[model samples]
Target: MILTVTLNAALDITYRVDALRPQTTHRVAGVAERPGGKGVNVARVLHALGEPVLATGLAGGATGARIRRLLAGGGVREAFVPIGGESRRTLVVAAGDDEPTGFWEPGPRVTADEWDAFLGRYRELLADAGVAVLSGSLPPGVPRDAYAVLVGLAADAGVATILDADGDPAYLGVRAGPDVVKPNARELSALHGIILGRSVTVGTVDGAVDAAAAIRALGARSVVASLGPDGLLAAAGERVYRAVPAEHVAGNPTGAGDAAVAGLARGARTGQPWPERLRDAVALSAAAVAAPVAGELSLEEYERQRAAVTVTELR
Candidate 1:
């Protein structure tokens, strides 16, 4: 079973507008609410794909309860530790003509006692987990090295861990050594102190292979870098591969990365080869981008796109 850990769980609210203009009023065309946080999003996608997943995280107050109910309704098994503080809410305003704008709350403050309680719950859950996914940001009062600690615990239990996060938590988690690390181009640049938008384009097979090798050398048993419409590039051990999407169907791009991580986790649990894993990741992410809601993908769309995913082994 796939075990997912979300440190700062949230209730995600998305609003779609024809266009966003500062200091102007606009009518919202649609809205959607979902239980969110990177790991939670990942678990939801896996559950939709018929994978057995256990989502563990910190939650509190009415919003937390709502999130739990929503996950249960979606057929995802969850084990969350309730705290005294209220969980956070995130707002995504998608402009019909442009990229979505995000407003995020830092989340509630967690106490030392609450942290300890969460650790205890994690230990119990990790005992039977096959693959562990540590994702999202740390709450205000939680330690920055939270994912690092969980990485150590999962490793001790002989479970491969996949980390999808950013900033210090991601840097610290890498030091703890996870089996796989999925980061988008911006996050990758931030981790390595490279400039954002300064990506090395791979128009040729050899260039893609070289870039994949370079990414793997930075640390990580495997690296999957999502390159927007260019598709995804993956490097595992000495083998490198690139999977291109069948078409570019634009919608809300908010949860594409989380969906990709879910696909990768599902593939890992099912013993799918690296090539298939890349294909699934690309297809799922593409499907997510085609959906109007954040962190949700159309399963039928994913299945249709899955068959058209073109993967080339560059190594």
Candidate 2:
């Protein structure tokens, strides 16, 4: 089974309005809530694809209890370490044709004892898992090197690990040498001013290529950069493959990246070749875009993209 870690899980709230206008009164047309955060999103997509995946994180308070209840009802196994503070909530407003606007509340502070308790729990979960996905942000009071430390622990346990994060945590975690690290194009652009162990700025795929390679140099076995709408550029072993979609498949894009991560995790677990891995990643990503709801993938679109996606090895 694949294990997913979300240190800062949230209650995701989405509101649909007829038209979202700035500084104007509006009535909500619909409301939806779900357990969220990068790893939770990935777990949901993996479950939908019939993968044996378990999700764990820090949760507490009424909101956290609600998140767990939703996950349980949805059939996603969860093993969260209870915390003292209330879990945060993410609010999204969808109006007209405009892209959804989101407001995320800062998660509650984690105490030293709580963090220590989690370390033991995480290691226990890693034993039964083949791949561990460490994604999303660090909660308040947690160290910036939290992901890095967890990656090291996973490594020590002989488990393959995938890290999907950004900023300083991303840099530190990459330094810990996970099996794979995934960063979106924009995340690569800044990279916390460190690429190839040197300070630099990058935003484009071309720039990320070098950064991706640098991350590999830092100890990660491979790196995948998610290029929005374009597809994926994956560097594995000594080869790089560019997986491009035939056309844009657009819908709710919130969980597309998470879906892509799930593909990579599945590929890693099965020891699939780089090309096939890229195919799965791009296909799942496109399927997510074609999905009607958040955290869901269109199986039909997934199958079609599997056949239509073009994966070319880049020299």
Candidate 3:
């Protein structure tokens, strides 16, 4: 079973409008809400892939309760620690004219006692987990090394851990030696303090490959750098794999990375080869992008796209 940890869970609200004008009123054409946070998104995609997963995180207040309900409704197993503050709500306004505008509220502050309780719960869950995913940002009052500690604990339990985060948490988590780390182009650039180019066109695979190698030098066993429309580049041990999407499907792109992480974890659990893992990751990511909501993808769509995923070996 995969154990997913989300320190800052949220009720994600997404609104679609025909056009968005700053400081002007616009009627929304669609509104959808779901349990969100990077770890939750990963668990949702894993569930969609028929994997056994347990989502563990912090939750509180009525909003947190709603998040749990939503996860349950989506057939995800969850174990969230109750806290004293309310979970946050993130608003995403998808304007037809441009990229979506995201407004996020800071999550609840967790007291020290609450943090300890969560650690205890996590240790208990780790005993049964095959892989553990530590994703998303740390909430207020949580230390920067929180994910690092969790990764260590998972290591002690003999469970492979995957980390997906940004900023200090990501930096520290990598230092803790996770089994795998997934970062996008921007995040990878931030971590290594160098620009990895704006695009991975045909002429740029060499640069991308070099960048991925640098990421592996950071101590992670494997580094999977997601290149958005160009698909993904993964450096696993001594082999490098590049996967291209079967075809472009137009839709919202949120949660596609989390879906990719899920695919990679599922592939690892099944002992799949690098090429197969890349294929699964690309197919799942494309399916998630084609979905209207974040983190939710149709299994049928994944099946249709899986056969079309094209993977190439770079080394």
Q: For model 3, how many clashes?
A: 0
TM-score of 1: 0.88
lDDT score of model 2? 0.89
Per-residue lDDT over 10-120 for candidate 2, one digit per residue giving the tens place of the 0 to 100 score: 999999998877898988989999999999999998898899999998998998899899999999999999999999999999877789899999998999999999998
Clashing pairs in 1: none
Model 3 C-alpha lDDT per residue in residues 4-101, reported as the tens digit of each score: 99999999998999888889888889899999999999999999878999999999999899999999999999999999999999999987758889
Better of 2 and 3 by lDDT: 2
Per-residue lDDT tens digits for candidate 1, residues 32-134, read 8899999999999999888999999999889888888889988899999998889999988977667679899879899999999999999999988989999
Clashes of 1: 0
* lDDT of each candidate versus the true structure: 0.84, 0.89, 0.87
In terms of lDDT, which candidate is strongest?
2
The true-versus-predicted C-alpha distance at residue 139 of model 1, in Å, is 1.3
Given candidate 2, what's the lDDT at residue 59?
A: 93
